[model samples]
Target: MLGIFDDLAAGNLAGVTESLARDVIYENPAGEQYAALPDSGVWRGREAVVEAFRRRAQLVDVLELQQRDVVAEGDRALVVTYQRIRHLLTGAEAGYEASALLSLDDEGLVRYWRVLSESAAEADVFDSDLDERLLAAVRAGDSREVGALLRRGADPNHRETATGLTTLQTAAGLGEATVVAALVAAGGDVHSADSRAGGTALHKAVQRGDLRTIRVLVEAGAFVDAVAPTTGHTPLMDALWYKWPDVVAYLLERNAGLGLHTHYGFSLREHFEYELNVNTRGKDKLLVAEQLLQTRTREDERAAGEQRLMAAVTEGDQAAVRGLLASGAAVDERFPVLNGFNDLHTPLLVASRDGHTEIVRLLLDAGADVNATEPTFGAVPLHKAVYNGHADITRILVERPGIDLDFQGATNGYSPLHDALWHGYEECARVLMAAGARTDLVGHDGKTPLDVATESFGAEHPLVRELAALG
Candidate 1:
């Protein structure tokens, strides 16, 4: 019976099926989850049990198999063994202490087998002697020992003791240029992936902005376009995501492609644009990124330009806006894709929303339409200024000639007065009303500004009660 099981483990699926009794049954430890078995959810029957072992064998290259103990009772047998599972592609090894409850038929062939083993997380089959020595040398940056070990037939691509990372990947991640060079020189696979994260040395170098390590890996033939398994992000994408200009340039010079899609379906160009508009940096960084992005294809350049404009507007950087305009940035630039609404924001509306008095004045002086309504929100500069409680800017916009103070948002039908009252901006609300701003404007929900204030503040606060009383 034990010999039959050994034959099965050796990949011979011959006459063992016919020897199993038709009434055989198998049982496993409670709550054990086998990857091959259906969650239905326990193991049962003879053929189904054998199929499970076959599937497990398919995922691993078994280097060695050894049985530790065997106990037999009547027609049943229990066997414990250790199996080494090596990942065929990456050469990673994992071990499992396997226990099988087997029921044999009268003819000496296995009838049913149920395996209760430690879960995958507990499996580690790699030889520790080589791993411990290599990590010690690599971490101490002892190139001599590293070289000697490699020459002595130690695996150069062995992972670190702490992080389960390849020596080259760890060196690059830690910015250890000497160790990286040594490992590369010792025939370490530059394209070797970290055992845990599946990232190559180039990916770590790009992420840490380690220019020296990046160059080393690139020179050693590491794939600059290698993407992380977790993120599906290329090395170039990682650099762009983190705003690492030097890494980006190095990878690009090596022809690292940037058009790869992340797991989130965003390209490297899109990530840069999103960061440019969303990050809290000042105009200088945005401008620098814009200049770098301009070196890309025409479509990417145009997208970056639009993002630059959005950043300038969102951050209220008057100087950046002026400088971009002076450098021939298009004043009427709009986003390429808008689901339904057109993109019609002028610099005035941007400045007014962000409370930038100087930018608003500058855009107005630059002949921007003061009363132009945004296509999505449908609010002019005056409406946004009034709603956001920029009283000084609002006062300037409302008092300007030909600017309408009663403009409403197209989507929500919210007037500037409603917006101010809802957000507890008393001074802006009072100033708008004092300047002949309509107080009775209703939103899409059939509630006026005073009604909103009453509902929110319960008409208890002096200012809220006062606004409600004005109705």
Candidate 2:
């Protein structure tokens, strides 16, 4: 199965065609539209299947199958695939969740091939001159061409049968306001559901973070609260996940639901907070926080402060870091109970782990304990800096008074030097050695730095020479 996927991804047609039986039955009931079209059908025989594929190449610029699962039982396999297509004629794109059942002969040739998909609306094998021209115009953002096509009797709401996407959906997804406005003026339906996940143009706009195109659709009577029937995702929820502040603000102004639970079972506020906490963009942190504040009730203030501080450290926002510290954020505040970090991280540990040298300096200057150990790993901030090969951070920690150079972490498994050697951090190892890191010290396994160095890179490597010189 993996070999078949590899062949398909690489466009190895011979590899694909050679594995099919001479009289194989390729039955695609969902592709009935293609049965009436030229050179397309429930192809029989290896020769007919190869010809069907040759015809398929005419309409597609790109075809990719993202494999999700493959379950095999003897000679039969049930395969789940996500199909992405870029049409050559329309220059439009579409994706579908597809399932296929295959029967392979004892000789490993495919004998019976059957397929099922979520919707027949996404069956895009049928093609015409007008359909391609209309979609190409829409995708290119050519408002004049789109208007011309509409006047010449093109369907303003014409959907790519394979992707279940209308011209408006593609325009909105691409953030083309001019094209969206042109289609809207020509009677495009803003609320039409797509075949894949039943998403409308508004959903696509929000998903793409296109404020301008979103406005055009909203003004054309697109619903702000419209949830995708398949995914149950509102445009607001999509905007929140993407960290689009302006989109979130606009949806809020339009009375979009704030506390709606996502498909993941978390409320919008919880998802926004998670996004804010994990985001590494400094400026975006503030914007997302402000959006959260606007939507958050007074009960969310306490947790909001901690999230803000953590976000600042995550982004290496020096100013926000100083401000949060000045405004009474605890220097050693613990990460929340369920934040998914393997260790309980303070701001200093987080900064050092992220290689934020300036933030690490700031946190240290603001009274962050350099030797403070994470509760889970029993590892200090310097251990993290060494593990991540932060040379500047290693220098900074070593320069500080009372800093432990050979602190054994987590039942004394790997000292900082041992970790540096094991992970091939030669520069950090050199820095640690220069800062009076003991060459005689061994880890819990009784292996010295030189032993680790010789084992990791052999005695001939430069690291062994450095560690030996330290002794």
Highest lDDT scorer: 2
* Model 1 lDDT per residue over 140-214, tens place: 878777766666455767766578687777667777777788778877788878777778888887777879888
Clashing pairs in 2: 122-162
Model 2 agreement with the true structure over 6-49: per-residue lDDT tens digits: 56656677887888888988776644343323333477998887
lDDT on C-alpha atoms for all candidate structures: 0.69, 0.76
Clashing residue pairs in all predictions, respectively, total 1, 1
Please name the candidate that would achieve the greatest TM-score relative to the true structure: 2
Stretches of candidate 1 off by over 4 Å are: 1-128, 160-162, 281-287, 298-471
Please, what is the TM-score per model?
0.35, 0.36
C-alpha lDDT of candidate 1 relative to the true structure:
0.69
Instruction: TM-score for candidate 1, please give it.
Output: 0.35
